[model samples]
Target: MTLSKKARSISALEIGLPIFAGKRFLDKDLNRCFGDLEASGTLIEEIRAQELAPLLKGTDILIDLHSTIKPSVPFVCVPKFDHPAAEIIPFFNTQHIITGDGLLTQDGKPIYADTFVNAHGGFGITVESGYENNSMLVELIRDSVISALKHLGVLQGKLECGLSRAVIEKTPYPLEECTIWDAYWNVIAGENFSWTKPWGNFDSMPAGTHFATSDSTKLVAEENSIILFPKDGANIIPGSEVCIIAKKQE
Candidate 1:
């Protein structure tokens, strides 16, 4: 009796949208189309991650919802640190968390959609939920979809939200796991890239700070960093990942 059911809210911009790019996806990045599902690789997010990877194979859990290309704050991502969605993410109220992240591609495996629902064993859960004109990014994405449906018990009782209880009386902010070490790729950004400042995701950044340059080369932040997923001028894709610099996992 592994309870709690009913999921499905998907919106890769309402089905892999890319009508002239604002940077998110067109033929890719439907969270990296589950390893490019090749039904002739018929784009449109590789046939929507090949019909949503057979409806997440035998699903058990999968939260995934994101929004950040600049502004930041809310966070959550899991692909490791013993992911069972990292044991229900401390019941999420978001204070930031990303753990054991690896393959941002050295020739594959960024297969996100919560990494293909954690490669079928389920328990995925992404949730960046910030940025996109943050005005409390819509009540913190409706309180991270009601705390990932009340700690995955699949929500219940008295609802009718619109936020107000100061998001369940604030407090959050102490999760911090972070992790990844350094990322900045856009593989020589085709002879140009930019961003010397105007950071975002977790921000901090200290040791050497310089931040970005690319083809002219110069990316700094050698240590004492935090930034995550920056994507400066967006036309990216030269091996992708334009920013990542986590730290605090200790």
Candidate 2:
């Protein structure tokens, strides 16, 4: 099933409260407007850095649970160093572990929760519990947390094991950098911008094939490339990612 349908299935979080409340959780970056702080630029960042950063600064271990857009097997991301985060990988049901030298993209963007928390002297790992809105997503989070708590000695119980003792190393899929040329809000009806084919994470397409287009302008594949994060709809904004053309890691 698609991620949107799965997310919509959870009526409590997706529809129920937001019906009367108006604003939804994903409507804005709540971190930026945490309180009545009407500041801008450096001052706003500085306030959050000093005040909010301290709350997680002293935390011994932090697990940031998140969801993805694709149907993914739950996985954990740990820093490459011989840290405590890597030691607890076998306790849960997840069979994938991504260990990075530094949790930053080639463009220097921090891609994992461990990136922020590790800077503040806390052992942190990011656990992606499959697609956001999946029925099993919460169960994955609960299982991971419970297993971790037991492992950390915070809770006493026989750990309920789910998966076997092997984990897929690093990332199952590698992403390549795709430059954003432009974003087109308008496209030809029933023939607007979209992937040339039905795609999964890391599904490859060959060169000279058109991946997406708005009007007559097409983003042709530059190489034998993989499609990443194919959007469900054609609502495009300026600077939004159209596609990341990548090849399999040889």
Candidate 3:
């Protein structure tokens, strides 16, 4: 029922490849290594980005599907770099759509797969499908793909593609249509940080509410916002992103 288990239920890019078998990466977190052509190093991830960036550039409509560590309401991210994924945002079943005006970076450099693609000549999307235990994650992902393809005229008819017909028959494309602005979590002052509470995705808090603490100081929300991708307290590290502030897009 957790995201990790659901993530591994599917295969790698190639059929029957149990690529997600082990840790997320062999050397580094692959998601953070993208968007820098000048990024250099002997680290396997660094080298992989050097090779993969060029290949992902200029893709017309690319979807970087992901899941969150904490259980969440599925949503989509449209990075602030003039990304072109608006046409298909409403195609999926998710109601929450985030478009960040603030640029998210790691160590003063761009990070994230969709941002890399968006910076290039393409429509890039980062779709975070959260915890859903009732239905298979793979089938839900497939259904989204099929829906998007049909909306774009790429697929035709009620082609379930071997997914459960019962699930597909009740599929609803109607969305809550929340266009939200984004802010990264603010607990970056020190290491070994922990949240004030176990905050799940989309948990709302008022302005001035302190959500996290390291040492004796607690981090406060500057605006009334909802949380997204709240990392477990155990994973806290210096300069690491803890969560995101999803605010109403005005």
Misplaced by over 4 Å in model 3 are 1-22, 80-85, 106-109, 132-135, 155-176, 184-189, 214-217
**Greater-TM-score candidate between 2 and 3:** 3
Q: What is the TM-score of each candidate against the true structure?
A: 0.31, 0.51, 0.75
Look at candidate 2 and give me any clashing residue pairs. 226-246
Query: What do the candidate models score in CA lDDT, each in turn?
Result: 0.60, 0.47, 0.62
Order of the predicted models by lDDT, top scorer first: 3, 1, 2
Model 2 C-alpha lDDT per residue in residues 1-250, reported as the tens digit of each score: 1122222221111211233243222322222122222345344333443454455455556666666666666665564435654455555456555543323433443333355556556566767677665965675466666665555556554544674332222221322231211111111223445546665544556777776765567767665665544555533322333333444323
lDDT of 1 by residue, 147-192 (tens): 6555545665446655475444222344444333333322224356
Candidate 3, after superposition: displacement of residue 113 in Å?
A: 0.7
Q: Model 2 off-target regions past 4 Å?
A: 1-51, 101-103, 107-112, 157-199, 202-250
lDDT of 3 at 43: 73
Error of 2 at 102 (Å): 8.4
Reference-based lDDT, residue 120, model 3: 68
